[model samples]
Target: MVQGVDSVRQLFFGRDDAENDLTDGLLSSAVFRPNYAYREVLSGRKSLIIGRKGSGKSAICRRLAAPDGHPGACVLITPDDAAGDEIRRFELQGVTADTAKSLIWRYVLAVHAARHLALHVRAAHGRRSSRAVGALRAFLRANGESDDARLYDRLRRGARGLQSANLSLKAFGIEAALGVNGASEGARASRQLEVLEDGVADAFASLGCAKTHPPLLYLVDQLEQVWTVDADSHALVTGLLLAAKHITGRYGRAVRTALFIRADIYDTLNFSDVDKFHSDEIRITWSHDGLRDVALARARASLGAELTAEQLWGRVFPPSVRGEPTAEYLFGRALPRPRDAIQFLNACRSVADERGGPVITEEDVLAATERFSRWKLQDLAKEYLVNHPFLRALFAMFENSGYFVTREVIETRFEVRRQALHENFPAYTDSLTPEGVIHVLYEAGFLGVWRGGDVVYAGGIQAPPGPGEDEFHVHPCFRPALNSLGTERMTVQQGALLRSDVDGACERLRRLLDRAPLPAPTHTETLGEVLSIETEALRRKTQGRPPTSAQLRNVATHFQTLADTLRQSGHVSHPVTRRLLDEARSLTRTAGGAIGSGQGSNSEG
Candidate 1:
């Protein structure tokens, strides 16, 4: 069994088949073998393997190319093998606009030729004949007229002779083609490619013997890297797809190509006329179950013991009270893609390391979960702020409200602020305030729906499950970072002045109403006029009286109307007003006073 730093390092960092064997040995009996859409690919089909970075896409590809004890027959060609080297060569050649197109063409031709050589060596089993000779002759005849004709001819003849002597063309020719002997490199490469293609065709023809299998499978991985560096990489990919389709069709199932590509890149392709390509191919999506199985298989291989993926996961990270082990619970509500699971595990490991623990624990998982949630929230914030400015004002409201905010309270508070601002500075009549800002914050994940029938600031907190399997809560992960305008003294001063105004207004309105009783009126209009007169009289008599009892009632009715309007407009319901009304009713019942009789009494004070 492997042990210690070197072994662990090899298990984690080794890239080729040898390393893979160790990994498989370590994990074989556990449970997490990659469930690549292998059946479809092995059945001579094309597919895409899409996943984010570190999603194990590369690992899955490697597994398919080199399964345990299997002399991997597949030829894996990556963009790095072709474009990476080509880009440096172009820079060395002093690339310019005039030569860019030629450089691209050469790059594509080189990659295709390399792939051709690999296929030839795999199929030919070190044999050469008239077909290989004829292909070399044809290549020399065509390209020999170039400036490097003599060098080309010599390399071409040498490559053909190597094949004739039963040597692997790929093993013998690639280095010669790329050798520092600049004068002969291009010609030699072209000649090697010509012979390689002919050898491949001839080998396939021989495979038509009754004892031989009909088709050979070629697995290509990391095709997405081509397009990442170059906008025109799509053309190369399209060409490869078309060529594969052609060979598979012409050979009548004698040869197959299976390409592994990222799903997002595949989606970006123009597949409007899918029938133009092989439309009957199978498509496989790696789901949560598939990822879990891969992890389990890896674990089994590592431990050399029987263990299901779930069991392995539980061993690594047991469930916690704060979160369950459901797939959604582990990887959020979205589909648990391969990358997400791996990242979560990585995060758990990181937390464990930070806390000086050798094994990952449930607490580590929980902490990682919160970290992931906060990252998502930050992403949401960036998206909201960049795409929607109106949300900025809404976010500010929640930030300033100290956690608990209701829609009605926000609207009422904002409207009052807006009116005051309008009166003070008619030039700036906009209603941008803290209340309005809270709404924006809600959309940005800083606030979300809470169980208390109103919105609450998320604050990055996650709720641990309580007794009876309660739902999650808006657990604060970190302290809020919001602009708190004005000092404590300023806030206290403002509150004192506002309270004094309110008290003075209440006293003046009470005296005015006591002095001028409303005259009894039969019609609604006449009663309204009497109430309006009393309201005005109260306003004049009091130093800061809001209005008469009738006016206060009118204002309350207006607030209710506004709340209804906001609800109709799709704003969330406000619980603050309802609570205020409930409190008022309770106070009235306890005091043995009429419901509307205490309006002039400064009960709020």
Candidate 2:
């Protein structure tokens, strides 16, 4: 029955285009919205590309990795790339967090410098080639890599034995065999590392790398994986920034390094020589038009159809029927991110499919509200969990259906709940100041004005300096779900208050909340699920899909609705039974789809 629809569905959805995942590889024909990042990063002139999660960090990284994505062929080092995991493994090893950051960066620069030499020597292909190759070979051998292995494999593994490289190698092998400790050992290690860097530089000269494919462009991404405000995490991050600053000092022009990073992480870290990292840094900003343009590109790719996002959307969901797209309408429930718009559409598509529908209707989008909320909550958990483990529960107080509220409400709520929340989630233990919470929420787009415009905050909800609304609007994206929970609780309160028993109402509300206790997430055994959730408290974090209780209730409600439809049509006996039996068979046969195998990036870095 659904055979022909499969092709159209495939076209309609296009590629996965997930914000958190990566594409298979660089594609010359991949749809990319031409922007300054392409030019700057390709030129090897920009060292840092900063943006929010859905802002195309990975997209740009993918482009640079493509053969033609940049003027010079690029070497990609993504956060998930296993070959490059060693650089980050420093912290996992005995390296203290405080010192790991710097060491990691230094190691990264040296390793890449060595890689450039390897690429150049191999490219040259002659006697000078062997000499040039030998220099890099010394580096690899010194670093513990097996020299006999194939060249391509070693390119990514780096020289594993770097730690003991210069440690007076057995001028006392006897002392080493005896496990004798040397007080001067640390200095020897440092000197050897420095010496290795010089060797890589010399190899660069020997390869005549300047004549090789322009300077090699080295792209570094996802530093936040190891980043933190702690001294050790900070040191590692600072070392990376220092590498960007002193690029010419070691590799000179043989290699150009670019890092795609989260701006918030960068700003929060305490690093030295900031100007060097900042000098060539470019922040990816989007205009309404800009976002629309990118959205169209993705939509086109997904649909495999010829029209822009606006044209396609208009054809499918015309403004005459749906009204013009307002920021609050298109992005009302989203974070004004292009990726969010795409995902929202995907969520709508998922709902519409069950209706045997071809065109996406307004009802479809609206019906996706709960699922969309879960998606955003999943995102919030993934992005902020490492920093704030109790994110969702901490914000439960503000879930009051106040779309607009005075600042006093926020302050009072925090004042009442701060101590209790702090005790549970230590991320904010030292930061319970109401103002801090306010700033954090605002900066992260959790709270904002009712609408975007100039106005006054007659109440204590002070408007930002120059232009903006005074009213606070729980962001349409996430507030609704939280508010929905509150509304359900309100029903319980209303019944208790009907008897003029105010105390009874208060007691009822307390009991209701006790039952809810912040919607603890159950355990997720899958790694993909783990990757999407970042908090230390994984079992309590939001899941990819909304809570199952809501889903089961929804299913029961749907069955009742179907029975009503069957009665209205007078077809309950045969058609209804047949449909119900088929569904039951399908679920039982498929094992509820959980047993299914299969399958499964991005503006956001």
Candidate 3:
């Protein structure tokens, strides 16, 4: 049966097992492996995990912390949760909670102490008899504390010890003791904080069997949440990450820490000092192919199906590939981000459930696509164009052009306006141009490029080509807004025909006629001259037949319409003189009878 059925609750619910364990679960489970990311972490490298929310960052963290066959190989910790616990347990030699805030140095020192303690515990194997443990005890005593001190006593607890103390920490109300103010006073406080951090690292080292085994791997998750809290929390989290980098670099043989962070927050944290953080430490992105494999593997696991990525794609979206499906086919025009693909499948599963079956059909997938497209567009509209007026105008123009505007068409409209009113406009009109507006729309996944050109529909925009492509298009949803803008600038007819009125057309024609400098007619002018030229040409074709009166009237009427249009639009420079002379002569020549034999045709005919 499909996972999510009966209720919307089930539809959105994800499997907890898939989240915690990597084997035999969701298709997404197999699709997402921490080994690649883990390898980087295990090598003492630092990197960023940039998937959107729910894209498996947390799952990857959990998996890395518990690699198969190496269950006791790594430590995973969240600073937000463990900070207060670490501080209180690693307070400076002469510090108390009241003066902890002043002892920033102790905090750093405590980290070292903590590291030493953790190493000691790992060496002792819970026996407290080894030389490392003895040396650590002596170090603690000499630095500030006595042998058999409570903190050292607790530090020796190890993984099982810490887990068992979970309730005790809660009962004693020491969980909140991990707060910033819990460390000791003065420069020693900095020392204490460092010691505390070191302790935590050492604890992790101990759990991962780092002392006698390979380097310990610790996965730090949810760094973004640090920024959401108060300033002190933010600083604490940043400090920890820096400390991890430092410790790993200085002690590569002993431990490694990999931090999984959101892409959006990576820059904000500003950990770019590669000399301090190491340039080789950062890994920021997962390629499209990598994400595709992740999605396919997860789907197979979730459905309990033994299928290759290709076969799995076929089962999920048979119509997309027809005979044999692939990840590219299943995702349609959308890029193969693991989260996007999984969410799509989830949406399809909802439709299938509503249809009373575990099976998802092509129709369901299409419906899901439509739903995602509309949702994506709404988000893009709000996020990108809600405030900028110029973008608003640009969007309006794009929409008016029926959503498939070429660069030339947009440039022409802008140029015409600029020439008419903004003659002093800057030269970089195209650079200051609103192409970015389209780009923003594209990035948000609302717009996509089509084969013929880019196209945005109710479903979403088609993907655009790389730079230097000939054509582009957009979604039709922009049509209404653009048409409205175009209507305001000039009437639809004016903009469409590139003329303000019939007068404008006539003025254009007059300009062309004047530029050619044709001779005026002997009695009338160019209008009559043109009519005579046409009549004579017709006569020549008809063996010297003259034009009929009916034909003459039709030709005259056409010219009069043109003159009237020109006059109305102020295109006729000498309208009154031209009208009086032309109208009178035309009336004086009114026909009284047929110009030819009853059965005869006119010369023009």
Per-residue lDDT tens digits for candidate 3, residues 1-605, read 22332222233323433343444333232444554655554454444444433445666676665545233345555544344344333333453432332233223323344444545564645544444334344434434433333432333332122222221122112333232443333343343334444444444444444556665555667654434423344344455555555566444455555667653344334434425544544433345476666555555545554546544445444436334343454454343344555555666668767776545667676566556555443434543331222333344345434443444454555554454222332432443343543454454443444333224322212344445432344542232333422433333332333212222323433455555433354223545544554544344334422223333344435445545444454545554325423542352244222222111222121
Q: Write the per-residue lDDT of candidate 2 for residues 473-583, one digit (tens) a residue.
A: 456677556755454355334323321222232233234334432223311211222232222122222221111222222222333333344344544453432342233
Candidate that beats the other on TM-score, 2 or 3, i.e. the better one: 2
For model 2 the TM-score comes to 0.66
Best by lDDT: 2
| Candidate 1 Cα misplacement greater than 4 A, ranges | 1-36, 47-56, 67-72, 81-203, 207-211, 229-231, 271-274, 278-284, 308-316, 321-323, 326-328, 333-335, 353-359, 371-605
Poorest stretch of ten by lDDT in candidate 2: 596-605
Which is the better candidate, 1 or 3, if ranked by TM-score?
3
Please, what is the whole-model Cα lDDT of each candidate in the order they appear? 0.41, 0.52, 0.43
lDDT of 3 at 165: 22
Query: Model 3 shows how many backbone clashes?
Result: 80
Which whole-number lDDT from 0 to 100 does residue 576 have in model 2? Answer: 36
lDDT score for candidate 3 against the true structure: 0.43
Total clashing residue pairs per candidate? 47, 11, 80
Candidate 2: count of backbone clashes, pairs at least 3 residues apart or interchain: 11
* lDDT, residue 563, candidate 3: 50
